[model samples]
Target: MEATPTRHPRRWLILVVLCLSTLVLIIDNMVLTVAVPTIAEDLNASAQDLQWVLESYMLVFAGLLLTAGSLSDKFGRRKMMIIGLSLFGAASLVAMEATSPGMLIAGRALMGVGGALVMPSTLSILITVFDEAERPKAIAAWSAVAMVGLVGGPVLGGALLAQFWWGVVFLINVPIALLAITAAMVLMPESKGPWRKADPVGMVLSVIGMSALVWTINELPKGGLSHHSTQLSLVITVAALIMFGIWETRSKSPMVPLAMFRDKVFTGASFSLVLLTLANGGLMLVLTQYVQFVLGYTPTETGLAFTPLAIATLLFNTLGASLIAKTGTRVMAVLGLLVIASGFVVLANMTTESGWGVLAGAMLLMGAGSGLAMPAAMAAMMGAIPDEHAGVGSALNDTIQQAGAALGVAILGAVLSSTFTRHMPADAPQMARHSIGDALAVSAQTKDSGLLDAARSAFTDAMSATFLVGAASVVGAAVLAAFLMKGKNSGPVPAESAVDPATEAESDAMLTSL
Candidate 1:
């Protein structure tokens, strides 16, 4: 006799735990931005060292996502989540105790590994626990909470730094992780996909390929395209990715199913997500520096400055779920991209003399657009996949965004560096030409007001150029989504692809028995 599936009485509570887990990760990312200047001052880090501090976490996070997803699917989501949280907490302690820049970077890289394990499982588990009808609302709530964390990071970091050492930011994660782990242990259920043989080769190739690609991008500004190391890195990156693609297509038990790319909605959604993240990643990093070094805002004041952006995101996220049901994913995504582009346009006109009011308006527009667009894009990508592939599907979604973010930081950082160098005064010190931080340091030491004015002007010009690039990319994505996602609306998963209630129930019985 077929057993009836047991419904989870505490599903909503489980979601709270999951969202808390996700929030810690999100907050960690943003907090680092606010803390970077202080870290550089304390650690005596150079421009390159600071870049690595930011990039190392993203590199490992993006590289390991697919393998982590496959592992979570093969073992169990709840088990993996616990393991991930434990590792993350341990890594946070390591970061807190780090005595040097390299040590901190290593700790952050370790945190990335834990993050890769946790991220996909959260979404996959959500998909499993909630039925199709409730999924969109659940996703919206998740996105909204994530935005809250994003906004809160600067504020939290500022507050912590005001009263404590820079390491306090890392320490904050330890307690949050402990709470998440404890709640998850009591409330979350273990679940896995159908058992399959492992694909170890695909995992190695993906990690190597992605790492090489990110490295090459990071080196491009320093070495240019023709440099020997950059050339070699590029070759390895291309070859490894090509091999990974071929292997996945031939493997009987592929870690990531390549067939999903055939769906226009999936492809469009993924592309949109990549572009959106790429634009935002670079823009946010640049803006943080601008607010602090250029506008002379203290860390606490900088955090307060982002309040408008957070409010805008919160307002729109609540409306996005219903908006998608009415206008469809295609229309919503395109419109959101357009709005984001408009925000970039507003920012492109900013000068060093621009007031906070001008910057706040840009943040508001960008936040509203992202809130409306991101959840809808995520829903389209998630909906197109079968429940059986949820772990890998969620991983793919995350992988693209991380890769885009890393690349965005690399490429856009390069743009800012080169532009600043070109516009800098010919007689500027070598240290001053390296970065805005360095420039400010040199100016302070030499008491060179002219050099300071030149640095500010050069950075403002570079900032404008970067915003234009972001705007162009977003506009291009808007056009592509329009063409590819035409006539498509966010809808329930097709019946054939959805999990059977009977099968789910039987699986629940088996798990309960175990």
Candidate 2:
């Protein structure tokens, strides 16, 4: 059943609660980066252990997202959300008390489980709460807040690390969760799906497919693509994906409707979103290390440097909503891609002498580019779907984004790492370049001045290469947007459906729109 509009009219209040939850989720997720060294020293963890600490949460979270969304549809959105928030808060408490790497990782996985619940429900709730006329504005507002969470994560994590212990990063979630839980109870109406059967087999196949695929990609730097283990992983991943496709096609209650791909708007929107994320996701890791290791900025200073992206994203993100209404999707998407390409070109030339003005200016342009493209992309994907499939569609969107981010980091990070290792001076002393392998391996050793200088210069070259690559990706996305996008004034899809349609008609129309 669809949610009845609240007579009380507290839409903004509900938005606030959801936004707070998003910020808390993102902050907790990245906070460990600032505290990794401290945690490793205190817990006596190995480098592999540290890797697992990050991967475990993401793996379980991405693996189970579709299942969680299906569960929420079978149950109720409000009910699932409350359960998720409460579980996530409890997981945070467990994380705070973790004395071992394994314990912390387990806690992180639990948090991911809770995160799966919150992710789809939050998007679905907004769709239910807003009327058709106001949805574009609501989604734009929601997307802006979500983007803020992304840009602010590391900055907030840095600030927290400066003042308190590593545990403080996880502890910070407590109050935000409390506020969201309380607000959701008061302001949000309970809603459930036009319910459908849950597909256990499809869920299993999706998890296996995504996990194996990600694992294969992540293994590339450690073991070359030709390694037997790598080849095995690739074979397994491909097999799982093929099985998933087959199962999804046959399943009466598919998690992600296979038919959505038939629509050019859906196909283009989903593909572009993934490609953009692949180019964009690894940027923070590159930029942060460049500032601190190469240029020797303190953590606090590093946090300050990201302010431009934070601020500009907010500004342009708000403007993006308006621009779409006035201009159209095709123009906004194409312009955004061009702007992003320009930003990457500038970033590609970065050096040790680069000042805040140049770096911040580039970042500002990137923020604006992301701000412009994301909402339009989201609109296109959602507009193509019917109301009944909102939960599934939201889950699929988040899944692609999460998986794309992981792959982006793996691919771009591997490239940067390989470039650094190949180019480093052979005469460099052992102590100076002790950790010289890839991005993760060598980032730890960028302490001594000689090594720092080498890494910095190497990173500059590597970053330039990556940015050029990203520019190319953005340009490609622009091409896709130009061809597939309907119009800027037009929502991502045709508008008649988003505004008013019966549930069956909505689903049928989605099938016809392509």
TM-score of each: 0.88, 0.89
Candidate 1, 1-514: lDDT as tens digits:
6764555788889889889989999999888887899899999998788988888887898788888988988999888888998999999999889889999999999999999899999998888887655566678778888878977888898788889999988898999999999999988888999999999999999899888877887787776887998999999999999999999999998988999888888888888888888888788778888998889998778878888888888788768766665555666677778888999999889999999999999999998887777777788778788777888888888888877876788778888888888889888999899888899999999999999999999999988888898898888777767666543334433333443455435433432342
Note the clash tally of each candidate: 1, 5
Q: Pick the candidate with the highest lDDT.
A: 1
lDDT of predicted model 2: 0.75
Candidate 2 C-alpha lDDT tens digits along 1-514: 6764443388778877777777777777766777888889988999999988887778777877777777777787777778888989999999899999899989988998888888888887777776544555667778777767766667787777777888988888888888899999988988777768778888888888877777776787676787999899889889988998998898887877889887877777788878788888767767777777667788767867877777776777778766664445555666777787788889888886898889999989988887777777777677676667777677888888887777778777777776666666787654333233343234455555566567677777777777777778777877777667552223532243332235324433432342
lDDT, candidate 1, at 196: 91
Where does candidate 1 stray beyond 4 Å? 1-9, 33-53, 99-106, 425-434, 486-489, 492-514
Residue 146 displacement (Å), model 2:
2.6
Q: Please list the Cα RMSD from the true structure of every candidate, rounded to 1 decimal place.
A: 7.7, 5.5
Local accuracy by lDDT, each model: 0.83, 0.75
Candidate 2 off by > 4 Å: 1-8, 226-229, 429-452, 487-514
Q: Which 10 consecutive positions of candidate 1 have the poorest summed lDDT?
A: 487-496
